[model samples]
Target: MKRALPILAVLVVLLAAIAVANPFFLEPAGFLAFLKRAAPLVILAAGQYFVIVSGEFDLSVGSLVTAEVVIAARLIDGDESATWPVIALLIVIGLLVGLVNGVVTTKLRVPSFIVTLGMLLILSGAVFLWTGGAPRGALSEGFRVFGRGGLGPVPWSVLILLAVGAAAIWLMRADFGKTLMATGDNERAAALSGVRVDRAKIFAFMLSGLAAAVAAILLGGFAGVSAQVGQGLEFSAITAVVLGGVVLGGGRGSVLAAMAGAFTLEALFTLLNLYGISGALEFTVQGVIIIAAVAAGAIRLPWKFTPRKGDAHAAS
Candidate 1:
């Protein structure tokens, strides 16, 4: 909780600026709407947090989200009855993708960065070939409800966000979570202490995949189905997690702070929009944030590093 304060404070300041720029932001409905918009990224950040904290990266999620939405639209094809089944299938697909990523990274002894980057390319190319540059198909109203509808004054997306946040926090408190932290802090030590480091990382990747699936559902509903629906989301999630003070090589940070970082990011974007900043600069902003955050992390841990398994294997 202590590590989260910096991001929380930044969020508050950003929110205050947003309120000043647009008085409507102070209203409950306005704020709820903002939360709804930010929900997907927040969820993605939580997922990324797990992978990063476990000392891995998941660059595939953005493409995973795009693939999910595209797959859902094609499968459901406006059939309300197909909605739930399609959602289930999306979750399964996400898990499978993550599993593949983990297996390739651990078993093949490939770097996680390389493995997930390959996944991102694979998914993107698949989507391009399947859609021929443009995605087709309609989402059912039932499917859209999760993104656009709400119960009374609150949104279903917001509710889902809360549920995801709670689950993330709980997982981090469990035995697996503690071991994951340990593995990130010192993989060799954790392995010698009887922790199954490989399995733990694979699980982290699966969680990231699950988060991408859920985020895809929400995004497809809210933003509609498009080939570019999830463009740059992976970077955005990474930026949010890093902004929250989570270390890039893993072994640090909290889930809640990562979520707050998402909110802060959204607020920063909102502020920029209010000032007439071009939306095209979003990727630019993300690039700056990610580099800065990782540099900061490196500076903080000036002399810390444990050789990865693949590195040690090669050395031997």
Candidate 2:
């Protein structure tokens, strides 16, 4: 929790700023609406945190989300009865894609960067081919409820976000989290300590995939179906994780911090919109953030040097 303080502080400040800019933001209905919009991204960031903390990246999640949404719309086709079944299928597809990415990276000795990038391209191409440039079909009202409906006063998306956030926190405190941290910090040492490094990493990728699937479900309901629904989300998730102080190379950072980072990003965007900033600048902002955050982290790292044999002898 200590590691999460900075991002949490930033989040609070952003929320306060929003409240000032728009007094309606202080109302329960307004705040709940903000949370609903932020839920998918927060969930995505939580999933990305798993892979990043395990010293790997899953670039395919954005494409995976697109694929899931497109597939869900096509299969569900406004059939309320098919909602549950199609959702199940989408989850399976997510796991399968993650499994393939993980196996290729860990077991086949390919770099995760290459593996997930390849998967991203592959999924993108496949979606284009499947949808023929435009997605078809519509989500049922029942399917949309999770993203658009609320239980009396509370949005379902907020409830789902809380559930996912709690699960992520709990997971990080478990033995698996310890092993994952060790693996990311030093793979060889973790392996020597009897940790299943490869397995842990594979599971991390799968968790990311699961998160993408859940996000896709919510987005399909909230934003409706679009070929570009998941566009740029991978970068957003990475930026959010970095904003939370998670090192790009991993092994340090808290899940709470990561989720807080997502909220912070959302709030920043909202504030920018209120200030009449163009949304196109969002990508530019994210680019600057990625570079700055990585540089800041590098600066904070202690400098280390090992003396050469001659220098050691001279010192001795």
lDDT of each: 0.90, 0.89
For residues 1-316, could you state the per-residue lDDT of candidate 1 as single tens digits?
A: 8778877887899899999999999999999999999999999999999999988899999999999999899889999999998999999999999899988987898999999999999999998799787788899999999999999999999999999999999999999899999988788999999999999999999999999999999999999998889998998898899888887787888888988988888887888888876788865775676577557655755354635446666788
Candidate 1: segments with Cα more than 4 A from true spot: 281-316
Give the Cα error of residue 196 in candidate 2, in Å.
Answer: 0.7
lDDT score for residue 243 of model 2: 89
lDDT of 2 by residue, 60-138 (tens): 9999999999999998999899999998998899888888988998999998899999999999999889889889999
Candidate 2 residue 170 C-alpha distance from true site, Å = 0.6
> What TM-score would each prediction reach against the true structure?
0.91, 0.92
> What would the C-alpha RMSD of candidate 2 be, to one decimal place?
3.9
Count clashes in each candidate, considering only residues at least 3 apart in sequence or on different chains. 0, 0
